[model samples]
Target: MPCHLILSKLADKCPSAVLAVLDSLVEPPQKTVNFKPKQDAVKQEVDHNEDMIRSALRAIASLNRISGGDCNLKFKSLMSEISKSPMLWDKYYSIRNE
Candidate 1:
């Protein structure tokens, strides 16, 4: 099963723990500033971070579905954070419409 599905199932049994995991997963990885990175490396990191955010949004949507909208407050808070970046907010808005 996909990680999101597994997490959704686990949410029924331990919502708090599952939410904690999701919260961590939703955070973007920090950029390493100690070295001058290549353009390709920067592009790859951006792509990876985008993918992570998309996955985390999917998981949150799944959780909201399974929990019958109980996750709305958390989702709203996440959306606020996501909205700080126009690119990410655009991605999220598209996903949310799907």
Candidate 2:
């Protein structure tokens, strides 16, 4: 979020800088794996991975609000995927409890 704040402050003066930061916020897709034997371990790993993705998407969504493009759809799509997961929306909000 600090990066989001810094980028937003720079956005008014330099939109290109904002776009660059937004573009970088998009993380590469993680490789899909199947771990049938260690179900709990795999679920933990997946939750952590999805949290990372959710974080990036949240930042991107914030940037999209300031930048004003069709990019919100992209961020929303990934967010929907997270919502559809077994872990649901809890992991995304769980950090706030801390």
lDDT of 1 by residue, 28-95 (tens): 31111112345667787776655665665555555555443445555556656667868666765676
Candidate 1 has what TM-score?
A: 0.45
Q: How close is candidate 2 to the true structure, as a TM-score?
A: 0.37
Please provide, for model 2 over 1-98, each residue's C-alpha lDDT reduced to its tens digit, 9 standing for 90 to 100: 35544544565567666665544443332111111234556777777655555554444444445645445454455556655765544654453243
lDDT of each: 0.54, 0.47
Q: What TM-score, computed on C-alpha atoms, does each candidate reach? A: 0.45, 0.37
Q: Worst 10-residue stretch by lDDT in candidate 2?
A: 28-37
